[model samples]
Target: MLSLILIGGSIFASCRKQIAVQSIPNMPVNYTIYDNSAQAIKLAKEGMLSITNVEVENTAIGYGGLLVVSRTITPSAEDLAYDLSCPYEVKQDVRVRPSKDNSFAVRCPVCGSVFNVAENGGAPIAGPAASSNSPRRMRQYRVIRQPDGIRIIN
Candidate 1:
């Protein structure tokens, strides 16, 4: 009976989800990028682009705009989209920029946190933010493929 109880407790512990150390207010994020648009064309060439949060044509640009990246050079590579806001700063104006030396990472100018944008979930890999008990990760949005282009939403 004791062994069973211990096993059950361990299972519960492992099931706990990791939570962000810092808190960021949720904001509306609904935007679409048409494949035929100039922005899409530019992204295809650059592989990365940052979009500022702005109101245009009834689309929500998200909390601090959006960071879109093409994971691979392949034409069919799926793009990943994340919020520009810095998790440690928690301010919409304070955002992370792509690392100059590494295309797969982003750095926060304010908190100095380096997030691995290329890996799973954009988790902080360096700086004070990652040393914390529960580090915060970049807020990501869902990108759904559309007939016209791609839709990003929270």
Candidate 2:
């Protein structure tokens, strides 16, 4: 009789559903990393625009937010837009230096996940992230060209 009761209780508990909810930021992060138009133009000309590292707060959804600097890749230029988030583990360790190959790629310093910046920083040809259980892809931001500079937003 005790065995039967225990089995029923176990089954009931197993049937219960568990859900987790996370708090998300209401307002978009407005980063004016590029002070003016010249700076934006300079970045466009250079082909790569490196911005001052800013910490992003929201991290529960997928990957942590990032301080993305905005600049336009000319109308004729092939556009490559990527979020600062890392695809493998949702978020990457702070201070991971994105690769400088001009291929728009970023390498996770901690896990050595090489992301192809060309395709929203997706998993690249080789890296530890290649064998990860979660085959995640990087977030890509929409790029819009304004009269003054480029705008990257959600």
Runs in model 2 lying further than 4 Å from the true structure: 1-38, 52-78, 92-96, 100-102
Score candidate 1 by lDDT. 0.81
Predicted candidate 2 versus true structure: per-residue lDDT over 1-154, tens digit per residue: 9999999999998887532112122324333324375545655566555443443444122234442322343233544445455555454343234576544556766667676554433444346555544344556555565555455555
Per-model TM values vs. the true structure: 0.81, 0.53
Query: CA lDDT of 131 in candidate 1?
Result: 80
Quote the lDDT for 147 in model 2: 57
Q: In candidate 1, which residue ranges exceed 4 Å CA deviation? A: 1-19, 71-76
Candidate 1 — worst ten consecutive residues by lDDT sum? 70-79
lDDT per residue as tens, model 1, 7-114: 999999989976666465678888888889888988777777789946467888778889887646323467788889988888889989989877788999998999
